[model samples]
Target: FYIHYIASTLKILHEEGYIYRDLKALRASCAQPVYFSPFVKASNVLLVEGRPVLIDFGMCKNISKTGRTYSVCGTYHAMAPEVRALSGLDHDTRAATTSGYGYPVDFWGLGILLVELLTGKPPFGYRNGDIGDLFELSRGSPSTIHWAAGFEPSRDLRDLVESLLQPDPSKRLADWNATLNHPYFAGITDDMLPPEWDSDLGTEL
Candidate 1:
C-alpha cells in the first residue's frame, strides 16, 4: 500500500510542479522507517482510513521551466547528492552550477523512502550519521550502493531504486508519466494512480 500511496503522491507532486522536501524519516536501526511508516520519521506522513497520506509542504518548491531552483534544504541520507553538495554554498556558487537542484531531488527522496521501507536501511548504510560520509557515498557510482542483507528485492524494484537514486537528476526518474509505468509500479491499482498533469520536464530530461 505504501508503494501505491507514494507512487500516487509522486504523480500528484509532479502534476503540481512541486517536489517533496527531503524526508528525515529513516534513522538508525528503527529510525522508524523500516516498518514503512516513513523513516524520515512519520511526522510528515499521516494515515487516513488506512491510506498513507503525505503531509508537510513547508519546504516544497515551485517548478520552473528548467526545473532548477536555488536555496538548500533536505535531510542527510534522503538528500540528493547534488542538493547535498550544493547546500551551504554561497548563492553565487550555487548559481554557477548552471542548474540548481530541482524535481529530481524528490525522486531521490522516493528512492530513499523505498529502500528504507523494503530493506530496513537507507542506501549506502546509515550506521554513522556523518553528513560528510553520506555525501561522499551519494556522489559515488550508484553501483557501489550497498543493498542490505536478508532483503533480496526483485530486479524491477532494484532497477527502479537505482534509477531514482541516480546522482545526476538528469538521469533520475522525475517524470510523472514515466514513473507510473515503471515495472516496479506495475502492480499499483488504478485508484492509486494520481491524475495526469502537464509538466515542463516533459517525459524526461
Candidate 2:
C-alpha cells in the first residue's frame, strides 16, 4: 500500500509535466522512486480501514528534473545521513553545497522507522535532547548503527535493517524488488501485509 501510494503520486507528477508518453513502459522500467517524502515517520502515516495512508506533503518533493534536492527538511532522528548533514544550514549555503539527495533518503528513513518500531527510540542522538550530537553521528563518516544492548533480533532482521540503514546511499537497500524479497519479509506479499497482523497469536510477553 505504501509503494502504491508513492508510485501513484509519481505517476501524477509525470502526467502533469506532459512527459508521460507510454505508461506501460514507464511502469516497467526499473526506475528509482522520484517522489522524495523526507518526512515518513509513524505520525505522518495514518491507518485508514486497515490501509496505510501517508499524510503531510508539506516537505514532499518530486525529483523529476534535476534528480536530486539539497533542501534540508525532516525530523532529525528519522532523517537520512545525507540530508541530515545540511539540516540547519542557511539557504545560500545549502545551494552552495553540492551534496544533494535523491530517493535513497527514503530508504534511510525506512530503516530508522524499523529501528523505532523495534526498540521504541531512534538509535542515534546527542545524549538527551541535543541535536548537535545527533549531527555528529552522521557528519564526517558512515554512521554506525547498532542494536541497543540486550535486545537481539534474529540475524535476518538485523541484516535487513542494517542494509536499509547503510550510511552510503549507493550501498543501501534502495531497490523495491530486492527489499520485497528480503528474508525478513520472505513470506509476505502485497496482499498479505499489515492487515494480516490482526490475527491472534498466543501471547508470551
Candidate 3:
C-alpha cells in the first residue's frame, strides 16, 4: 500500500512537471505548514484510512517547465546528495553557488524511506541533526547501507534501495516506469494501484 501510494503521487507530480521535494512521512491534515521551519520527515507521516498519504507541500516546486531548480530545501536526513551539497553554502551564498537539482532527489528520499520502513531507521543513521555529517553519510558508497541484525531484506529489495540511493542523480532511478519495473515490485499489478496511477508511464518491468 505504501509503495503504490508513493508511486501514484510521484506519477501525478511528474506528469504535471513538478517534483515533490519533500517526500517524507506527512500527516494528511497537515498539507500546509503554519510556521517557517518546514521540513519533511518520518515524524510527519499520518495514517489515513489505513493508508499512507504524503502532505506538507510547502517545499514542493514546479519543475515541469524549468526541469530543474537551484534553491535547496528539504529535511537534512532525507535530502539527496545533490541537495545536501548545498549545505556547504550559507543562506546568502546559496543563490550563487547552487547548481540546481531535478526530480531525482525525490527518488533518493524514497530509497531512504524504504530503508527506514524495513529496518526502523534510515540507511545512514542521523547524527544529532548535523548537516555536514548527514551530507557526508548520504554521499557514502552504496555499501554503507547497514542492515540491522536478524533483518535480512531480499536481494531485489536491497538492489532497488541501492539504485534509488545512488549519490549521483544521473544514475539514480528517477523515472517512474523504470522504478515500478524493479524486481522489488514484481508482484504488483494495475488493479492494486490507485485510480490516479498512470498506467502509461512506461511498460511494466
Candidate 4:
C-alpha cells in the first residue's frame, strides 16, 4: 500500500529536479528533522491521504550540470553508493558510471521501503537500530532483498524492486515513461490526475 505512494513521491521529486537522497520512517530527536546528518536528508515524510509528502529539505540542492553534490549527507542505510564513495566536496562521479548520481540514491531508499512494508522490517534486520549498512549494501547489491515471513511478492513487483536496487546508476530505473508502463503501476493510468492539474504538469507543482 505504502510502496505505491513512495514510488509516486519519488517520481515527483525526480521530475522537480530534486532528489531525496534519503527516505526513512524515523522521527528525529528534535520536533523536526535536523537535516544532512543522521538528522534528515530527504526521506523524512508524512502520509496524507495514503500518499507520501517530502518533509525535509535541508540536504536538498538544485540539480546541476555536475549532476552531483559532495557531502557525507543522508542516513547510512539510505545513502547512495556514489555518496558512500565520495571523500568530500571534491566528490567526483566523472569516474563513476556517468549515469548521474544523487537522486537515484533516494530511489534506493524507496526500494528498501518496499521490502520493509512487505516484510514487517527492513530487508536486512537493523541490529544497530538505525539505517546503517542497509543503504551500504543496497548501493552494492539489490539481491540482498528478503521476502516477508509469510508473503510472496508477485514476480512483477519483485522485478521492479530489483531494478530500482541496481548498483549502477546508469543501469538503474532511469525512464519515467518506462516506469509508468511497468506492471507495478499498471492499474493506475495517465488519466489519474488531481482536480486542478493535468497529468502533463511534469512536476511543475
Per TM-score, the best of the predicted structures is 3
Instruction: Name the weakest run of 10 consecutive residues (lDDT summed) in model 2.
Output: 22-31
Screening candidate 1 with a backbone cut-off below 3 angstroms (N, C-alpha, C), the clashing residue pairs are 24-40, 25-39, 25-40, 25-41, 26-39, 26-40, 27-31, 33-39
For all candidates in order, the CA lDDT equals: 0.62, 0.52, 0.66, 0.57
In Å, residue 178's CA in model 2 sits off its true spot by 1.0
User: What does the lDDT come to for candidate 3?
Assistant: 0.66
Report each candidate's C-alpha RMSD, comma-separated, in the order given: 10.0, 10.6, 9.5, 9.2
The digit string of per-residue lDDT tens for model 4 on 1-205 reads 3455556666777777776666656521122222223323333432333233556667767674565666667765545556655633223434344333666777667766666545556665563663343444434555666676677889898888888767667677766566666798777753353233223324432
Task: State which candidate, 2 or 4, has the greater TM-score.
Answer: 4
TM-score of model 2 relative to the true fold? 0.63
RMSD of 4: 9.2
TM-score of each: 0.73, 0.63, 0.75, 0.65
Q: What is the lDDT of residue 53 in candidate 3?
A: 66
Residue range with the least summed lDDT across 10 consecutive positions in model 3: 28-37
Q: Pick the candidate with the highest lDDT.
A: 3
Q: What is the lDDT of candidate 2?
A: 0.52
Model 2 ranges off by over 4 Å: 1-46, 88-98, 126-133, 139-143, 146-150, 193-205
Q: Model 2 clash pairs?
A: none
lDDT of 2 by residue, 20-77 (tens): 1111111212112212233323333334434443344456676677767777777656
